[model samples]
Target: MNNPTNSKNPADVVVIGAGIVGLAHAALAVGRGLTVTVIERDDRAVGASIRNFGHCCITAQSGELYDLAQSSRGHWLYFAERAGFWASEAGALVVARNDVELQVLRELAGRREAGQVTVLRAEETTAQLRTAQGTPDPAILGGAMLRDDLRVDPRTTVGKLAAWLQEQGVDFLWRTSAVGFDDGAVHTNRGTVYGRRTIVCVGHDVDYLFPSVSKEHIVERCTLQMSRAAQPAGLTLGPAVLTATSMLRYDAFTEMPSAIELSRTVDSGLQAIGANVMFTQHPDGSLILGDSHTYQHTAAPFLSENTTDLINAEIGALLGMPLEITERWQGIYASSPNGPLLVKEVQPGVTAVSVTSGVGMTVSFGLAERTLNSLFESVHSHRGSS
Candidate 1:
């Protein structure tokens, strides 16, 4: 048995947090031939990794962020094939409930590149999905569009990925909370361990790890509501759904002017309906729907129904057809102020990284690898300078 405490640093690199982003970093560090050790606060892999809808979006993703998202999606598919990973290529559909949403579709269409997102007219969208119906009110002037997004079971995916990492010889420590640390060592609840360098990835719980940086860094925790339903297979509508409210809020559609306006231009009908649905499926055959964003410096107790009611309305607005309700749950993700993400050194050897924004399940792997590279590269550069 190896003792990090005894060795004063048994691992060359120590990563805190075992969430998808942290695990991705562990995997890439292992691949880079570094003696890697991972520490997690929870006994089991939890956090946003297992709590999200698991929609791997690509099309309509704007700026350099698309590159990482594209690469991450590839990694998911690779793991699926290897681990007999359960997944569905059900695709996605963005429904425009108003003229603003329709404008968003047209803008996304004009900008779509290899990401595989496409804009479809009302008839075209109906032709593709065969489920969407009823013409929009002339005042609404909305339609549905197509996006090549994949949905996966975060619960299943995180577990399978954990298994794969162990198979590949990556070291792990569960229920090990890190109280404090810098580059030379990572001090956790289990004991004080050493490493040549360290990376902090506390997610929305950054306040616990890097208290000093938490004040300056624009990282905050966002709590959201989610629910599952026994919607018919035909009710899936063939793809995922991002409502106009979502189109307005999410950059993938809003990066373009028209999409932004549609997002901003609200209709009382939708407001009355509380439309903010982003629909995707799970391997368990349950539909994943929701989300309302509420940020805080500290974690909040799992309570409140306003977000749930609003999310359900969003779900209902898109999947208006009849469906059976199954379960309700809550989740939290890290939200960065803007830009792709920032991974920089807080001190000489201590590095901090957070992709709290963009709900990056779409790019966790690639982002992890990239973050790992920066950490080690800094170590190398430091050595060369010394």
Candidate 2:
């Protein structure tokens, strides 16, 4: 494993998985002047990293997640510039249909600092919807704009970031599966790769590599259905659109006083599906709509049309028109009743970092930053003691 082959061999850091989480760690490692080797099981990231609305739902996070989301916001933009990828500061629009939902938005806006969350009038909110039909949803009372949120093209960001990381001298082992981890080393099917430290960001597949750790954390898979709809005629959306169900999903909004009432107002069918009804428009003008959460120990390899129909119908009503589904996929990420994050030391010099929730896109870079800081500080302190 320690055998030297190239200049980048025996890297300073070895990262497992090439999804956004892994790539983020690799990119940040490079930023710290560390030689990084990334191991991916596939030729490209085809997982939860690419299967999202690309919204960095920043303002909706609370407590530690909020801090991390804010930190991640900067890095997402930083790397986007360095990597020449498309990222927008378009923020997020939370459309409140009824007064209960509008109350939730207003409460959330009041809690945040001025300009961070802006409560909008019904006409202003409806203007942002850009409906292609006769009229927007009449139920739109008012809404709020989450000013710190961001959007990127999930389909392309990972690939471009990976490519740019390679250009920065980070080595990528695509199609290489990491089977095991030892102190300062990663054992893959191809061969053992040595590094000073190893970080595993394998998302839900953490169970596949470290079963005990996965079980100890009560890690399971949370699968959701997402779809892409063709662009509506003459419609262009900037900010990611979130709805009443979204208020139920994010912590910041849920903590509001009106959240319970808002939840009660949500349709029972939506609640049954665990829907977080939201959409973001891609550069191509196609809208990415999704998603309903279903958690289990093992993810079923099937998509429920009934679930999709219910969710899409809800989104269609919000948009005042029916959606033309172009593509659909099931996104599976690590989930736990324990917490939204699992960052544990599996072995000496080996750490496993998994966002045990769906905010992977929102917190990837910031989480990586914290992990690296801890790793480096521990090393510095140990060397000084010795």
Candidate 3:
């Protein structure tokens, strides 16, 4: 087992919160040959990192996020291979059940390079669903194939990555809660862990440690409902499936010219739930379906049956089959009205990074790369003058 206590020797970088964001930072630091230590309150990750679809929603981002997601794609594959995690490059399939939805897909496809986003015919889209009865939903108009997206098993990827990082000589202080931070030390419940730099990545709990910074960024906890169901009959879905509701959520799709019309055309029931009717299949033949968005300063612990039903029903109708839910949970992530990211140097040698956009999985590695690159450059420049 990896060490559960802080190392006496100071590390080059110390990361708080062992979710994807923290793990990504530790991984990048290790790659840079920096000594690192990761602090986690839990023995294992049980946060938004594990309770997610694991879909790196790459192709559906716009502008800065799109560039970051594209960079994240390579790093995801790189770590997956070396860390021995399961990652699939099957991409994503956006299902359009109506003409307006199809138009949005067409517009997006046209804007992208060839093969990056391929608008598919109804029959082609149906084939990608892999339904048991070999039938397509009557509402299926057409869809688009997003070629750059990737998937990892959210339940296991972080655990595997954490183990791999430990193997790479990154120290881990599990069940260690970080209570405070200074220029070169993290004051944990157990004791202080020294490091040259400290990165706080506590996700939605940012307010707990840095209330002012969290409040400054207008950060809120975005709670989403998700469920897992046994695979229907012979269903063998590869690509992550997205629906018209998803089009309304992702910036790339929302930016399309037909997006407004598509929005107007969506069912009121779906809009009521703030649904992003999407699903990704696990290797175990189970389907991970989600989700509905609701933001608040403090997330409600309750999961609404009505919300889950709305999302699951939509997914079932798209698959041409009913679902038998085996598990259900609420996913909480950092969100903000101000921006998608909160990368602020809260104090000297201490930075707090949070993906306030709920795209942590999509932008994890890339954001870490940008953060570390800037830090490294600044460090080198400071040393050069000193």
RMSD of 1: 5.1
Error of 3 at 215 (Å): 0.5
In angstroms, the error of model 2 at 249 is 0.8
1-386: candidate 1 lDDT, tens digit per residue = 22347364368777788877777777667767787777887877878888887777656465666777766666666666665667556667776656667766776676665445555666555443333442222232345444456677787777787778778777777878888876587777777777777777777777666766766666777777778877544543456666666675566776776654562466554444334567676655567777666667665768556666666654554443444568877778777664457577877777777776755677777677667656666432101000
Runs of candidate 2 with Cα error greater than 4 angstroms are: 1-9, 378-386
Which regions of candidate 1 deviate over 4 angstroms?
1-9, 123-148, 236-238, 267-275, 338-340, 377-386
Give the winner by TM-score: 1 or 3.
3
**Where is model 3 more than 4 Å wrong at Cα?**
1-8, 378-386
Give the Å error, residue 349, model 2: 1.0
Measured by lDDT, the strongest candidate is 3
Q: On a 0 to 100 scale, what is the lDDT of residue 384 in model 3?
A: 9
Report, for all candidates in order, the number of backbone clashes. Answer: 8, 0, 0
TM-score of each: 0.85, 0.95, 0.96
Question: Scored by CA lDDT, what does every candidate get?
Answer: 0.66, 0.89, 0.90
lDDT by residue for model 2 over 1-386, one digit each (tens)? Answer: 32323334589899999999999888888877788999898899999999989999999999999988888888998888889999999999999888899888889888999999999999999898866663668899999999999999999999999999999999988888889877877878877889999999999999998999999999999999999999877778889999998999999999998898976799989999999999999999999999999999999989999999998988888778888999989999999999999999998999999999999999998898889888875432101000
List of clashing residue pairs for candidate 1: 92-240, 93-240, 99-140, 100-262, 104-259, 248-263, 334-356, 335-356
Please give the lDDT score at residue 63 for candidate 2: 96
Measured over all alpha carbons after superposition, the RMSD of each candidate to the real structure, in angstroms, is 5.1, 4.0, 3.9
Model 1 lowest lDDT segment of ten: 377-386
